[model samples]
Target chain A: MNPLRIAPTDETPTVNFIPDEGKFEISGNSYPENSTKFYSPVLDWLRRFCAEAKNQKITLDFNFDYFNTSSAKYILEILRILQDCQKNGNECLVRWHYLEEDTDMQEAGEDYRDSIDLNFEFVVREDTL
Target chain B: MTDKQLLYAYNGEMSNPVLNKILSTIQTKLSALGEKRNVVKNVNTILIECCQNLIYHAKDKDTLKEDFFPSVSIYKDAGGYRISTRNVVAGEDAQKLEAYLAKLNAFSPEELKNFYKERLTDGKISAKGGGGLGLLNMIRASKDGKLVYRFDPVNEQYLMFTLSFLM
Candidate 1:
């Protein structure tokens, strides 16, 4: 399947999902007015990828500076989907990145790591944009 | 400027574009306040959550009075910054929110963290993608791990819901 790329807006994040290379990423702030509408297609792509992707190893990267509560729910949903993919015998790893000084984002990643059973790595980058 | 003065306040209809404008305006004001980067970010996050809560959950817009229109404000306090929002909600929704806030206020910081984790994967996403995590996130974001709220009954059908976070 072809890759999916969504440009980020003031209230949304940029989503880059590449099924061919098994590289998926979501970055930037996400606090859309209608989060369900914004995330429906991304969730659909993940479902399709999990069902049809032939890649044996998948790495999903999440680098979010800030997201509202509704977006947080969808982020958890995406992680849950990847967890299911891992459970179905696919090698999957999630690189959760945050600014070194942003403890809130780091703790958010930790919260997801604690909730989902998957290979998760927390990467702290510099606080530069 | 007074230390505990009101920094920003808006009392009117809050749409998506208006929310964005409010956020940017507040961000600029906060920058001018010369707060630390982390402090500014924390305040910004809390403001976004509170404003979005008003935007998404506010009901009976057509019947809103001038004083009861959806509103949000930021204040500088002795401890830290406080963000507050007020909107109209149905009586049923107000009851649910009051109960939820009571439950959240009962938890310690660590317990709230656990509760947030549990609710994240509860698979009960609402049509608006709420999944019942907004209040918990607010409480966790608050410096005191507490969300202050009040419900003023307007009539048999609707009530005023006010939520505030100190961060």
Candidate 2:
């Protein structure tokens, strides 16, 4: 399958989910004018990918500098999908990279981790956003 | 002053640079007025939510090839900023909104945090729209100060929501 790559906009994150490599990353701001319109296709693609995800070691990296409530809602959707994937016998390592200075972003990552019953790691990046 | 007299109006497309500049201006002015850091962040987040609300939910119409926009206001009080938005809303929409805001107004900070976590974990609520957090953020921002809210009926197709957040 072709790699799924979405370009980031002022109000949407860049989504890079490569099934071949078992790596995923979502970064940037996501306060899209209409979040449902922005996130639906991505969610559908993710659903399609996860349905076929087999025996694969998956690593998801989330480095969201800023995401609006709607975007945050979609992130939870992604996390839920990952949780289901993990339940299906796939070893998934979820990594959330946040800017050291942004206490809000760090807290957000932790909040998501807390909600899911999965082994997720939070890493603070210095000087580079 | 009557609410109508106090409203400030801007109608046009919103650019990121313009929004950022306006937000900075609000922040700077509030800071000069002695707003604390926590207060500033809260007010800023609510303001952002309000602006996004204007951009997203406002009824759009193409008349003469221009998109009509919602009228939004930002006012300075002794304690903080207040935001009011005017738009045409259906009765059902208004009723739905009032319930959410009422629930938000009722929650304590600890409860709001728990509510946010529970909502996140459920993942079922997101389908309704992520916009629910707009009210929650307003509540979180104004934990110490009550959100003064009023919804007024206009000439049938319009409802004006005047909401305040004391930072």
Candidate 3:
């Protein structure tokens, strides 16, 4: 699988998917002008990558400040893929990193954790930028 | 300047940069008045989505020769910023929008949040259907704040819906 990385802009976030190291990350605000135009490839890559899985421990980190509805949908798709990986006997860990004071992000993370059976770790840190 | 003055100044034609400047100016002013960073950001997102909604779908049959689009207004009241839009849409669409508005009015904060999450689960990452979530986000942003709304008619064929976020 090819390394997937999309840089963040004022309207969207940065996405990094490294299959070789089994490390992935998505961070920033995601309210793109056209959400599908932005997220289709990411979903396709995830779909293809999961079909050809290795027994590596996967660590995916998410540190989004905000996201729109369309972006939110794609995020859940990514999580569902990770959940699939976990169910298939791969060690998948979701590290949901949020700002220290951003209760919304924390609550959102909790919401996802409650609905999904994926093993996730919620961590908070200062905005530190 | 007054809202009518601002609306009249458009003259049915505006350069992209000028219109963007106007939209950005209104957004900046309202965001500053909202005070909270998240609230400001929410307002910014809503206004952008709302304007895009207008640009895409605002249609009026009688005004074939006129600029049949939406009129966005940012004003003040005893409470907070009153951002509004008057877009000419189809009668059927107006009814559908009213249904959505009624649904929004009926939902509590928890209900809105739950609905957003559920839709996030069910829906694909599409732009058109994302309109519903934008409305939900506006509702979420004003959970503890204020949301005032009204509907009016400009001609016999169109309905104008005004949504206000009370700072």
**Per-residue lDDT of model 2, residues A7-94, tens digit only:** 9865578889999999998887676656787878878887888888888899999887557676777888888888898888888888
lDDT of 2 by residue, B1-167 (tens): 22322323455555445455556776686677686654555555566776766555555453212323455567665544566655445557778877877877787778888987776555453333454566666566563735667777753654555566654
Is 1 or 2 the stronger prediction by DockQ? 1
* Model 3 CAPRI rating: acceptable
lDDT per residue as tens, model 3, B34-140: 55555444455556555545544545445533545456665565544556655566677778877887787788777877887787688554434353466666667
List the TM values for chain B, per candidate.
0.90, 0.69, 0.67
Docking class of 2: acceptable
lDDT of 1 at B154: 78
The candidate with the higher lDDT, 1 or 3, is 1
Task: Write one digit per residue (lDDT tens) for candidate 1, span B51-140.
Answer: 777766766646567867888888888878888888888888777878888989999988987787777777676765555676777788
Question: Quick one: best lDDT, which candidate?
Answer: 1
Error of 2 at A59 (Å): 1.8
Which ten contiguous residues of candidate 2 chain A have the minimum total lDDT?
Answer: A120-129
lDDT tens digits by residue: candidate 1, A39-108: 9999998998888755379999999877887788888899889988887778899999987778888888
lDDT of 3 at B32: 52
DockQ of each: 0.66, 0.28, 0.35
